[model samples]
Target: MESSLLTCKKKISKKCHVPRIGTSLSHFEPKKRLIVGTKPNIPDLNLELPSDSEEEEKDASDDVPKLLNELEVEIFARVSCFEYWKLQFLNKQFSQLLKSGEIFKVKRERELVKPYVLMLTSGNSRWTMVDKSFKNFRRLPEVPSDICFLYCDKETISAGTQLIVVGKEVESIVVWRYELELHKWTKGPSMITPRVMYGSASHGTDAFFAGGIKFVEKGIPKVCTEAEKYNANTKTWTMICEMHKRRKFCSGCFLRGKIYVIGGRYENGKNLTCGESYDEVKNSWTLIPNMLKDITFKSSQSPPLIAVVNDNLYLLETSSNELRVYDVNENAWKRQGVVPVKANEASGWGVAFKSIGDRLLVIGASPLPRSFIKRMAVYTCRPSPYVEEQVWEETENCYDGVELSNFIHNCCVMFA
Candidate 1:
């Protein structure tokens, strides 16, 4: 196991500080919580870079003799070290700086040179503005029907490009698009396959689906492990890495442009301790280590929340209240914090939580004072972000009728 990256989280006595807009010095405190979403959290959609070398990290520090007859500076909001490229859309200084390639500023010493615009993603769920600082969290509403699988919609752009895509899933899979700027969900292209209890991971516009059951195998309860892919640019489907084992309720995530799959229930048993990673470039699935738990992810009620921070992969073991981080390069596992309020009977059951950004937000149908109110909870929990990530809602899409129950002249037809 790689001990370097797999150590336990170091809790700070107090928060770190990142200076505000006018400050010249560089200081940053990580966010308080990972944003919550409708269903199972999906992949970390944006850039996941290891800390670069000191020399390479400082490569862009030299001041350019302020160019004469200079191009006007384009203003951007506080976009992180990544997603700085969407600046290309702007005609003025935005285009020039994007071409300059000087803003890959990894150094905390150098504060943001360019600004950023945050696109809030939305679905059927509504936003409950918490406060001014977090922008205010958007709360997820109850699904009219039972959930199958949840996916956080994501897109790819040139490294520094900023494009926010959001869509919560429904019982049925339907073509949908989320306008981050508008903070709304609308229909988009339909999927060729309608899969429930399956998870989707992506690189840019390219997305891949893995391990979900199409139907309950009537008398013989069997789960499906079929893996599929979709290309947003092409608007088509292509199958990719088939997991070493078949599983349902499996969770998939994309980190460093690769797919890292973990903790799913299969027909053979509840949890598949083993891990799988598919390299898009290589077009393959190499089994890593199986989870140490003698019993892994058993009876997963929802797709697991999976994310990567500092290249170490982490996930919320749905059935169990604890979180686990698997360091692929190091071949080791480390246990993390417990989900807050997991013990209370009221706090337990019928809960939904997924990782968004650096935080983990949870929503559960809770029994409240006088009446049962569906409450939402947010926590600035876990270690460094393994990667930029978002939560997804479980919904139905392209798949047609799950089963056919009809009558023939002299016979009965039942599809399962």
Candidate 2:
């Protein structure tokens, strides 16, 4: 006789870009608009998250245990790591699972949701899916797929409350945002210039988009020097000061309200050794000294993931997996830590932490057509040993008028 008892698996495995409609205002390429074509089957409304069925919540004894501890969370999260297994069945069973609230769910707003890190990466443009967070590790695949190897022309996180994703499909920059708690995505205003491979950073509610090359022809594009900004409240974009130089495949992060755009390859396709700073208050860009070591704005597909902690910027070269810190106040760069594993950026740029205090989590994905991982690898900012621990404990010997021994014997069993 064959056994028929159902057993649920723990740590299920995982699986696997842009907006059309951006441009580098400079060069004013008429053909810079990217293709914003839609697929035949893409639903008008795509839904993500598990349903809070009345039945599931009502039963406690029959409830499935939630893996919330850090280690357990990471393990189950690593299962589909880069959306490997996710893409496998996302079409059918996954669809039903999501619709029925079986796969993933949203946190209650009333409950204090512990702040966690969020890292975003869009996969092959053909079926691009946004790989998010190592904590909850969700596969909310709704991004439009355009071509084969589509990349994020640009991306920005709004206080981690929303994801302001703007990118170029072929020429135009398409804009979309993911509302964190709601677990839903909504369309937003597009950029005037469609840019590919640009840098973005936000201060308060206003987001800034800068740099990125615009395609003028099939195989030719020019690095742009234009800068633009978008405000969530106004839902509008305003053009601002352009950079002193043109560069693409660069990275940027906000430090103490200043946007530091750094180290992207020049139009010449050479790694950029120099960087710059942009101040919105002054509406100007200030040229900074060249980095101590050379950093090419090559593709994010490789290394040099830049992130910020306490307004301090740092870079992680995937090629070396060596962590380097850039002290904004000191105006200097120095090595901080090293990653334990070697990360490949072949598919695209590895993810940099936008939320970790100062540690940036770097993740990458290569193809494994035959394996579960069709694309994407997941790794977090190997935590810093130097971070301070301020875990506070509340020692209550007894409630208002209760005795310790009385309560202990009443609620707990003491071993003999």
Candidate 3:
């Protein structure tokens, strides 16, 4: 019996023998191996583990509640203004932070302000506010006023966050302001000398209006040289030194830290080639004679189509549809290139030419074939005074299927 047991034990020991190092185990039946000090082979359960990003987000969500409100505002202030609308919808705290205008104040302190274009096209009583890319736009609330004021010829300019529209009512010339913060229109804070077709310009938080026609006792239009400075924060207008010459239908631009009024007619109905620049330091006007003498004038032309970019003045000559840059030292305009739009068709009536940041923006009816159905074209160019030819690129239309009239009645850029 002992010999038989010994023989069975020997057989079992041989069947369970450990394979030598570097030896093949192919002859053995396939089974998971278990080592003495290591974990046994186990099937994968496919469990999902939290990723680093998800863990970090969880940590931030947990930590946010501990931050103070002032610290929260400081954090939100660094966000882009384009995301503001979305942030306002996050919670009541964020909505109140934006509504209180504290974010904008912080942005101003950090020099993070952005520019928006406010334009009133023909056949449209409401104004359109668009971003620099023209990708996003919203129609402003309609001005609550008489039909005469809505349909009449109006002048628009922006200072700080206020868009001021000046138009003639049945009884008087009135000022209607669109406050961005309030998102509504309010009348009053009328100009000291209410006028139309004036040369207007904006700088920082102030807007300057000068040299337009005003109605007198008999409703007869009389040209004037009076100027006024409007403070957006104070919501008041104070009279400033008058221009050197009485100009009507003039165009104004802020250049080299001064307000320049260019290319308008005198009271005698004769076109004036001279321009004037207002120096805030001296509080006086410097006459720039023969500013427009080199360029030809049309029989009935609109005001000089001018814009300032990088402290340089540019003109869109409507007669020839030519883009010219002013030579400060020579007092002459050097032709840059021919514009794509037909500015001469209506003598620059329907075209919108203005500066947007470092680029010059032009919006008007395309010169494409009529079969194209007269689509409005939007083009922008980064112009350099030294470059002989400017290359203009078309921007994507984002009017949201609204067929806006190509005739832009009022357009202005506001940096807020």
- TM per model? 0.49, 0.54, 0.81
What lDDT, from 0 to 1, does candidate 3 have? 0.84
Clashes of 2: 48
Query: Candidate 1 regions off by >4 Å?
Result: 1-73, 76-133, 137-172, 181-184, 215-222, 231-236, 292-300, 317-320, 329-332, 343-375, 382-416
lDDT of 3 by residue, 136-214 (tens): 8888899999999988899889888789999999999999999876578999889999899899999987999999999
Candidate 1 local lDDT, 199-237, one digit each (tens): 556554466777755544343344666677766434566
Q: Between 1 and 3, whose lDDT is larger?
A: 3
Against the true structure, candidate 1 has what lDDT? 0.42
**Residues 1-416, candidate 2, lDDT per residue (tens digit)?**
00211111232211001112332334223223322334344444566544675333332222233422222333222233234245435455334433432222222222222333333333222212222332223334565545521443444455324556655565355777755433566665667776767877766556777888776676577899998887754678889999987878767767776887877777777767677788878999988877635432334443236666565666665655566666555666565555433333332243333344333444433223436343333444433424332121111221233211100000000000
What is the Å distance of residue 326 in model 1 from its true position? 2.0
**lDDT of all the models against the reference?**
0.42, 0.49, 0.84
Positional deviation of residue 64's Cα in model 3 after best superposition, in angstroms: 12
How close to the true structure is residue 298 of candidate 3, measured as C-alpha lDDT? Answer: 76
* TM-score result, candidate 3: 0.81
Model 1 lDDT, residue 267, Cα: 74
Candidate 3 worst ten-residue window by lDDT:
57-66
Evaluated with TM-score, which candidate comes out highest? Answer: 3
Please give the lDDT score for candidate 2: 0.49
Candidate 1 accuracy as TM-score: 0.49
